[model samples]
Target: MAQTVSFMAVGRFEVREQTAANAGVHMTSTSPHREPIRVGVVGLSASGGWAATAHVPALAGLDGYELRALSASSAESARAAGEKYAVPLAFASAEELARSEEVDLVVVTVKVPHHLELIRPALEAGKMVFSEWPLGADLAQAEELADLAHRRGVLTAVGLQARSAPPLRYLRDLVAEGYVGRVLSTSMLGSGWIGGATYDDNYAYVLDITSGATLLSIPFGHSVDALTMVLGEFRAVSALIENLRPEVTNITSGEVAAKSAEDQIAVTGVLESGAVAAMHFRGGTSRATAFHWEINGTEGDLVVKADRAQWWYGGTQLYGARGEEGALTELPVPARYQRSLKQWTERSADPACSVAHEYALLRDQITGGLAPDTHGVPDFRHAVRLHGLLDRIRGAARVGRKVTLTEQGS
Candidate 1:
């Protein structure tokens, strides 16, 4: 049975007090929104990318953020982005934008290799920073940035937006409320980035294990994180990783690339709750299903399935069955679980929904003067913890043995 915890809702903000020890884990809190925060987005390109499509739309739809400045690789690109986005200030370099008095929050949307370089300046300036996931090139870099943020006492956030995803959030509550009885075991199977036969030119580097944005690190990472958000952390895990697709054709470049990245990944683990868990991610979509997940408990079961691998993008369906309650039937998310954000409608992408939630949580934290861990916002330390987990999973695969996880944090 799950422990009962009391909570209070203030508008869309939920309030609960958590000790400071859990620095990077999600807690709860409530506070009214304050003045709009001035944001300078690094890599907000006019040419369109993740930042342009997701962050731009997400921020534009939010109330507490003012998209003030943009930074690009070149002065011309910077000026062009500013004109296109209607941002008044633009800089050719991240340092200039981070140091500007006009930028209260620095949003780093650059490539994985550039995160450390782009985010360091903002951290040094004691400005709030939000960087995309795979927070650093590797665990070491991620820890370095996290340590800097901690030392500087500046608020920080990461792109592990899976926690803020609406359906995932609802799923968490359902599990905590014992909707599935006692979670005996959980499993997930999904199509991964490499699952496709062809790849984009931009993702060519992702095919290399050295890039840090591998099949195991991104889609797999995000999926696992989202799973843990609802189920709990793993106590130990055994994993197998293989590079079945050693050679992949780049659809855009019309070239065959030697892919060192693993395309077939599998993991079996024990959750903190003592429930068994297993996950398998493959490079291509299945002929029958794109994604499927099941949670079996002593008295009931819950299932979440999606047509695409990125369910966090607001495209998942829920089903449940209790005792002999016929077959698993669809469970509609209640209106109460829906946040009051006007932009948090059915049309929002998974990234946009999660980003908007993170913004709201940060706005409340800054306005309420709450601690970092006191909300569900995933921060740098959270990224470090995830990095450690990934490392352990890799180790398990390396040694062909189940490894124990003792590292702490979210």
Candidate 2:
């Protein structure tokens, strides 16, 4: 019989341990022999946010995981979200959710600035934690959280969900399977859609570099993460980061805001496999190409294009040409690449698609079905490494020189 823990937020908070039948909590599990991993989401709001848009739908569509609890900024909001999402429990803060025995996994979906505070409690409680991208506001915070998670021996996952995307996974396999036969060079150009000449009042924080949610860290960070996954880590890199748009108009209130976050980022690096890599990311949508990437090799070439830089969302198309081929032809990602999420292919444009895939990988990881080291899910340690790389990029840009990974303590 599966054990189900129940919680009642009566004025304060109370926990009661019981079976599903006795607690009157309906347990939904895809596997009859195994219980679902109960998940508590921090920052789930009734008004709708990334957590509502992505994580709610993701957990809803997947098995072996249940959206059990949620925490909002206030008790009223938490209760509202609980009722809206049909979650069994709700809390006013992340610490309450983290300390709950009912929640086997605590997912931190808040902003970058609050990531350290939200994640620290979960790690301290020895609960499995899944934090969104960037991991922290900067390298120091990420390193600190990673160190704490390590000390706690907790299972951790970061929201580098592009690694779980079907197309990206297929692309990685193709490159590994010698589809492009010893890649000689790769180039990518993208538009971040933020840090542009216009901004939304709600997203004004992105214009501040101190927020750590800049164009370079959000869009470029996600895109580059996928790039490194397909290819390999950078052995050395030279970068140029510039703030082309110093002022941006607020689309909502028509007020002008001074922007410090960079609008342009250029990076050139050597991959661990000795392949040359170059990437250029600019703010705002482009009339010509929003996103384009090409990999050239001795025997063949592959190209990936999307309607926008955020390939993880949708419109990611793959094309390739080899040896005697006269033209590049579209290469459809095979069904096998979708794994258990083949049903979600049609909904690839939805933000929940890749998130669902990531949740599935996390489920596998937690259920002992997937080895921690072998699974493609980026953990806290991986986040720390990526954060360090971003630091190196900033350092290189500041010094106007090339930075070697080994010399920079990679």
After superposing all C-alphas onto the true structure, candidate 1 shows an RMSD in angstroms of 4.8
Report lDDT per candidate.
0.79, 0.82
TM-score for model 2? 0.90
Per-residue alpha-carbon lDDT of model 1 for 1-410, expressed as tens digits? 22233444322234443435433374434454455778899998989988987788788887778999999999999999999999999999999998898888899998887788899999988787889888988899999999998777666778877677666777888898998899999999988856366788777778778778877888789888888888889999999999887888878777887888888999999998899999999986777777889999988898988887666555678899987798999987776555657547676445577677667666666456545433457878889989889888989999999888885632
Residue 224 in model 1: lDDT? 89
- Angstrom error of the Cα, residue 183, model 2: value is 0.5
lDDT for 362 in candidate 2 is 68
